[model samples]
Target: MLKKLLIACLLLSLIIAGGLVWSYQQVKSSLDLPVQTPENVLITVKSGTSFRGLLNHLAEEKIIRPSTWTRWIPRLEPELVRLKTGTYQITPVMTLRDVLALIASGREHQFAITLIEGDRFIDWQTQLTQAPYLKHASKTMSEAEIAKAIGASGIEKLEGYLLPETYHYTAGTSDIELMRRAYQAMMSLLDEAWQTRDQNIPLKSPYEALIMASIIEKETAVDDERGVVSSVFMNRLNKGMRLQTDPTVIYGLGESYDGNIRKRDLRTPTPYNTYTIFGLPPTPIAMPSKASVLAAVKPAESSYYYFVADGKGGHKFSKTLTEHNRAVRDYLRTLSK
Candidate 1:
């Protein structure tokens, strides 16, 4: 009876060892197997997704072969169980093991949103709304609430606060967080420009310089014209003359602007109309480039106080209204020709 019991115990041990080796081989095969995708595919691992759940999803998508052995992989490599929530790219060249490693590493694909110079805040909002995988938390909030959420409290206007640049972010990033980064970037550069500004500039504060920059951004797209345009506005400010810029009038018109600046529109009174107001508008009209901001603080030395489109995709600057009127006449003549 004792011999029989010993033989039975040995047989049980051999069976257990053989089962363990088979399980190990199955797990290794599952890990080494390539994902079944013929092309690159994007997969979103939502928050609170379990490792088993992710594997089940991959099997459902036909991205990987279904197997019970995959359960042992996470047990052996504990890090694979901590799935990171993000959008990941799975390619045909990737194995099931590679996909697991990528998800575990939390290296999600990056996306970019470009906020263009001279574009309005409304335009940026539109872009944010259309951006994929980004949480649209700002959609439910008011503009004031958004400003506060982004830690921009006490700001009268949200426009011109954010720097215009291509911002990169991973999936699940909030719109407010993106905006906050842009605002911080703008503040950093604005602060630097303000501190190193020419002391003789007529602008009182950095905000005022930003306001001037916004105006310059609207006036021209020519890189070389920014400094001269800054001089024109600065000279006007120093001489106590009304800015009389048509862009200000158009901005005040808002949705009512019929794509043309009429004589009546210029004469109309609005808070944003520089023709009616004595100084800078209450807030910036649009986002300005860093070059425009720099030009505002360091204006060229000139007596010029007037400028008009020269009919050649550029402007004609003049020191006197008489010269400006002549330039306008020449511009009109060119248009007729």
Candidate 2:
């Protein structure tokens, strides 16, 4: 009877070990199998989603099988499971383990919005309001209110404060957060450029450099002309000459401008009318690029003080009034042709 009892115990122990090995193989095979979807799937895990709920979602999407293993794996291996809230991209080739590891890593899909150089603050607001992915917090707020909310209350205007570049964010990101990031980026770049600014420049502060940069952004579309344009403006500033830039006058005209700048527009007395202001505008007219900002701080060494559109997507720079007038006449002759 004792031998029979020992034989039964040994047989039972072997059976238990064989069952454990079979269970391990089953779990490993399930984790290694690819999902059913032919294309990549985008899954959104909402806030406060439970682990069981996530498993159910995967089963519903047919990414994983609805079986005992699916239910038991997460419970048994809790250390390998981490659930997060955001949009995730699940590929067809992903295994159960790959999907779990991706969620655990919390690297979600990012949506992008670009703020173009020379765009006005209103344009930025429009893009933010139109982006379907962003969580709009200031859709109806005034510019002043928005500025205050973004910790920019000290800024007199919001036109040139934000940097122009592509910004990527996940779902539920607020407009205020995006704007704050842009503002901070511009501030950091401006501080760095100001620290290394050329000596004896007429700019009183970084704000002045920003004002000049905005003008440079509007003056020319040619990348190489930025430095020369900055030099022309700086030379004019040193001589107390009016900037005579059409964009500033148009900006001052605002809604009144009917796609034309008459002689009267140049004589306008608005704060933004550089043709009459005798210095940089009260604030930047638009967002400027990094190149324009650098040019503002370090203008090219030149004697040029005048420029006219050459009617070829570029400018004809001049060092004397006679040369400028001749270039203007040539441009006019081309227009007549």
Candidate 3:
């Protein structure tokens, strides 16, 4: 009777071992098998998510077969709690392990954009509102409302609020957050420049310097000559002369001035018009870059008081209005030719 019982127990143990081996093989096969083809699915693994939850979510999406999991646990027990947060592009045939690896690598997608300094508040709205990743978009809010949402107070316009930089935004960012990031970037630049300002420069405050910088930025895109142009404007400001900037005149027109700037528009009277205003415009004409801001704070030492477009993507600097007129005439003659 004892011998018979021992044999029965031994046979039962052998059967269990064989079953466990088969189960292990099945699980491994399931995890290593080719995924279903031709389907590209984007899955988001939320922060603080577990590996099992990811697997279940994948199963629900039908990206991976449910049988893969059912067959997986008995033999090849995987640690289903180690997946990380991220946005992943999952192909149909990827193994569960491949998905985990991708997510663990944190391969979240990004949106690329370039924000140039000295761009106006309206320009920022145009760019951000059109971006797919930025949300909470509207067409009706005035510049002030938008500025307020971005956390700048008493803002006449968005001229100085938006920072210029190459930005990479994650998917589904709110407009307010995007604005906050840009605003923060601008502030950081401002703080750094303010600390290192040239002490003897003629400027009342950082804000005033920023305002001048905006004017300089709007005047020309030739980066190498920004300092020279800024010096000319600074001279005009110190001498109490009219800014005579076409951009401020154009800005004063608001929505009426189409893509063209007519002669009549220059003579029009508006509060923001620098051609008529004796000093700086009430607000900046565009977003000012750090370089332009620094240039305004410490304008290049010169006696230049006037400038006219040289018609070659730059301007000709002059110490007298007579010289400026001559330069303009020369440019017009060249254009006529």
Candidate 4:
């Protein structure tokens, strides 16, 4: 009876050891298997999601096969279970271990939206509407309402307030947040430029500089010509000459502009029409880039009071009307050719 009892105890120990080894093998195999995804996919782990909960979510999404071995991951590796809440991308070639490590490392995916220089605020609205993965919080909000939402209170217009650059954000980030960042960035840059501006420039304040920058931004895209274009506008402003810029006239026309600038458009008076107004328009006409902003504050010293497109992707600047007419004729001659 004693020998039989000892043999039974030995068999029981062997069975228990074998079960432990089998469980270890199963868990190891599951962790090593590739995630079952055809292409790269984004997964958002929300706050307060447990390790087991995430595993269940993955299984439901068919990214991972549900198995009993996966249940031991949290217990065996407690550190891996401390998942960070963010959007993560998982690829087909990634193993279960790789996904866990990625999530644990808290490396979230980023998406970008670019606001272009010389583009209108309305253009940015269209871009925000089309940008993927971002929450369209400002879609239904009016410009005034959006300005208020982004903490840009007292700002009558939204144009030229937001900086033109590429902004990066994670999934589910709000458009309002992005706009706020842009506004703050522009404010900071504007302040820095204002502090270091040439004291002799005609701009009375940062706001006026912004308006000039917007005009410069629209006038030229040539890298070396920005300062010279700015100089022409500054000279005109100092001499009490009309800006007579077509962009301002077109801006005043709004939807009435039908691809061509007619004589009647210039004859009409509006707040944005530089030909009609004596000084800078009530606000910036469009978004200005950093270069344009810098050029507005620190223009190149020149006597040029006029400029016309030279048909070579640049402008021909002149100090007198006769020279300007000659340049215009030359531009027309180029067009004729």
Best by lDDT: 4
Worst ten-residue run, lDDT, model 1?
A: 74-83
How well does model 4 score by local distance difference test? 0.92
Tens digit of per-residue lDDT, candidate 3, span 66-151: 77445355234545335667566778667766766576666666767788776777777778777864566546767677777778
The C-alpha stretches of model 3 lying farther than 4 A from their native spots are 1-41, 45-86, 89-96, 102-107, 137-146
RMSD per model, one decimal? 3.8, 2.9, 4.1, 2.4
> In model 2, which regions exceed 4 Å deviation?
1-20, 37-40, 62-68, 256-258, 332-337
Q: Is candidate 1 or candidate 3 better by lDDT?
A: 1
Report how far off residue 132 is in candidate 2 (Å): 4.2
Candidate 1 per-residue lDDT, tens place, 283-312, comes to 898999999999989988888999999999
1 or 2, greater by lDDT: 1
**How many pairs in model 2 have backbone atoms within 3 A of each other, for residues 3 or more apart or on separate chains, i.e. clashes?**
0
| Tens-digit lDDT track of model 4 for 232-273 | 999999999888888888777888889999877877889988
**Cα lDDT, all candidates:** 0.91, 0.88, 0.75, 0.92
State the lDDT at 77 in candidate 3. 50
In terms of TM-score, the best-performing candidate is: 4
Which residue runs of candidate 4 sit more than 4 Å off their true CA positions? 1-15, 46-53
Residue lDDT tens for model 2, 124-168: 888999986789999888888888988888665788889999999
